[model samples]
Target: MSRRYHRKSRQFMIGDTLTIPQDKPDIEFLLRMTAVPTIDKATGADKKVIFSGHVLVTIEYVACVPDGTQPIHFVSFEQPFTGAISHRSARPDRSIHLKGLMEVQELQLVGPRQVKTSLQLKVCSVKLVRCRSPLPTHAGEA
Candidate 1:
């Protein structure tokens, strides 16, 4: 038996604060930022589907310096997140497939050595039923 079903996408917000190393210079200004989200596991229970994942965030910025010349620096970190969605056909026996899209909604510098970021994740769930067919005993038999 095989069946397909589509449910409304679920959205979640993840926030994190990063502290720069003591040896590194203070952040002067941000140049660029990027975030990538990955789904580690998905499970169904009762009438809901749950998922857990992590996001990799990288930031490029200019470091404060005594000289007028500007120096560029980069910092990267991972943030873990978890969320759940309600569905009519969700069950522990059913397999779930998840597709996710992530966006960096907000980025702010809390201080000279701290950075804050807010990320939004949108997840779409697909339920799949796998069927196994028995093989014939003889090659000629159908």
Candidate 2:
């Protein structure tokens, strides 16, 4: 009689290493980091859904300058991730909607020229089913 829906959420971790160019100034400290996730593909199976996508990570840091001034620099990179979510209502015939959220969990400096970043991606899935009801025979039929 009523519409039915199923929901599931999954979390994934993505890690990447970035190397600074020789022409760029040395990194003095990190200022801020952000990430954005994009879903590339999604597939629905018997009772599970598989997804693959990439996250764009941006890093802003203060670079050491010879002029005794702190200069801000930015670097961006893309990292790929894949994950799956299982739901009892998930099926090839039903429709599934996906939402993604990403956060920069950790950042570490491996060396003067390299940096390691850890990102957490949260994916939410909702399965929708169409509800059908019999039409009334007459306008006032109860």
Candidate 3:
């Protein structure tokens, strides 16, 4: 499915998978504003959020802290609904997980960040993976 997020007069359209990285201190929160899935780490306890169908992935990033002590802050947004299931599952967060050791170009992928301002960043890499849906059922449930 196709979706859009409007922030600071900029409209970002991210479909399937999107990657973004930051290496400088500037924008502080994932493109000023965006909608991201709420991960109920408590009761949800779902480290792996299995999604299917057409998924809209949005990767937002904030400016990196000057010091290397604090890890850069980045968040992924996903809006998925029932559709043709062409892609099955998409995890923009995985790109964050796979950071510090890869590059979008090396992975044959590109991030959706403004090149003009994004220049401040030394982005190592960003990645988005498309795969089939997991077992369409809850854990321990038949």
Candidate 4:
């Protein structure tokens, strides 16, 4: 007797344009991705098919603080974001390619104590390839 097996191929793509805003005028800003994984806090067993990553945002600007008025200051922080994609499982074998572009949309100052900025984040592409192994392995064997 023999069993029937299926061979399937799936290619998922993700694309979007994001409008980001800031409270202060930043001369420059840099975004760095820290980690990418499956099953973010927002999606759990819902079949929503979501992907998430940790981003580090660094901003350089001028601000006035209680200590004194500074001409330049550097601020850095981490943020987590989630994006929807075609339903797929997050596994080691799965191939994921992510790319993004950032640009300054608008910049203004509300008052002497406050600054406003608008940023645009364009997600060029996020591609994932789903595949499976045909063999089984035991825990004790390598």
Candidate 5:
């Protein structure tokens, strides 16, 4: 029998964070990666160093509110994402943080009865924080 690619009605969101897991398919999910500079070292002065690396972005899900009672710290937590990355060398357990605009390639389904789903996302958020980004506090907090 021939297989068909029909994406289920999944929820994908876009924000400063990666939402969905690496095993979910969402629409409009992405994170574009790029390199930028920061005023870390100023002629010998110690400054806040900015990190630019590749980030794995995926829209897991969205939590909408009837009333607009959102907080600043709660914004990035709403729309979540998971950053996928590739390291340069000698780095076995690390990957560059992704920062930029995430692009939504398309939704893909694996099985007929919806075995699994995958979303094509591009990382597009600035590498503000460099860490594993645990699922607990990882969503959208880029």
Candidate 6:
């Protein structure tokens, strides 16, 4: 006999544009992200996933040195992101959750010491409830 179960999943996406802090001039910036999961609320078979995370922004620039040469400088900043994903399932207690992935779509140097960035994110929502069929009865057992 083979065992089986039921599973359901859905995917959601979001996009946004943001500006870098104008603290210093930057030649380039790289982004790295990680997802932090949070449950927003639960009501009548509906729930909200608070998709939040931190972005590591690595900035590279040129600095003037006393020897009449320029040295490259590197700096990092941790930025936070927050969004909500709505989902509905029959059972919210048995392994129902959301997973998020992020990507930087575009980054441009818009002005001196400023940059415009665009991001795209995908959220996968999964719900695994109880088994669909009943278990087989053993011989001589009720």
TM-score for each of the candidates? 0.78, 0.76, 0.21, 0.38, 0.20, 0.46
User: Model 1: per-residue lDDT, tens digit, 68-133?
Assistant: 677999988888988898877778876777666774357899998999999887776754332244
Q: Lowest-scoring 10 consecutive residues by lDDT in candidate 4? A: 133-142
lDDT tens digits, residues 1-142, model 2?
A: 4232334878778897888778778888888877777777666778888878777777888998889789899988888888989877776665556667764368888877788988877877744353243222111000
Q: For model 5, state the Cα shift of residue 9 in Å.
A: 26
Which candidate number maximizes lDDT?
1
Query: Residue 4 deviation, candidate 5, in Å?
Result: 34
Instruction: By TM-score, rank the candidates, best first.
Output: 1, 2, 6, 4, 3, 5
lDDT of each: 0.75, 0.72, 0.26, 0.37, 0.27, 0.42
**Model 3 lDDT per residue over 42-131, tens place:** 111123232222222333344545664444455443443321111123233332111111111101123333322110101111223333
Counting clashing residue pairs in each candidate, in order, gives 0, 0, 1, 1, 34, 0
lDDT of 4 by residue, 1-142 (tens): 4221121112233222222336543333232222122222222123333445433444445555455555575554444555654433444455444443343234344444333444444332233344453222111100
Assess the local accuracy of residue 2 in candidate 1 as a C-alpha lDDT between 0 and 100.
34
Return the lDDT, model 4, position 90.
43
> Weakest 10 consecutive residues, lDDT, candidate 2?
133-142
User: Across residues 1-142, which tens digit of lDDT does each residue of candidate 5 receive?
Assistant: 4221221111233323233333433323222322111111111112222222222322232222345443211111122243333222213233223223433423233332121223333332222322476222112222
Top TM-score hit? 1
Model 6 per-residue lDDT tens digits across residues 1-142: 4231122222333333434455543444334323222333212244554444544445555643456556566655544555555545444343434444453334555554555544454444443344454333211100
Model 1 lDDT, residue 114, Cα? 94
The deviation in Å at residue 117 for candidate 3 is 17
Residue pairs clashing, model 3 = 103-125
lDDT of 4: 0.37
After superposition, the stretches of candidate 3 with alpha carbons farther than 4 Å from their true spots are 1-71, 85-142
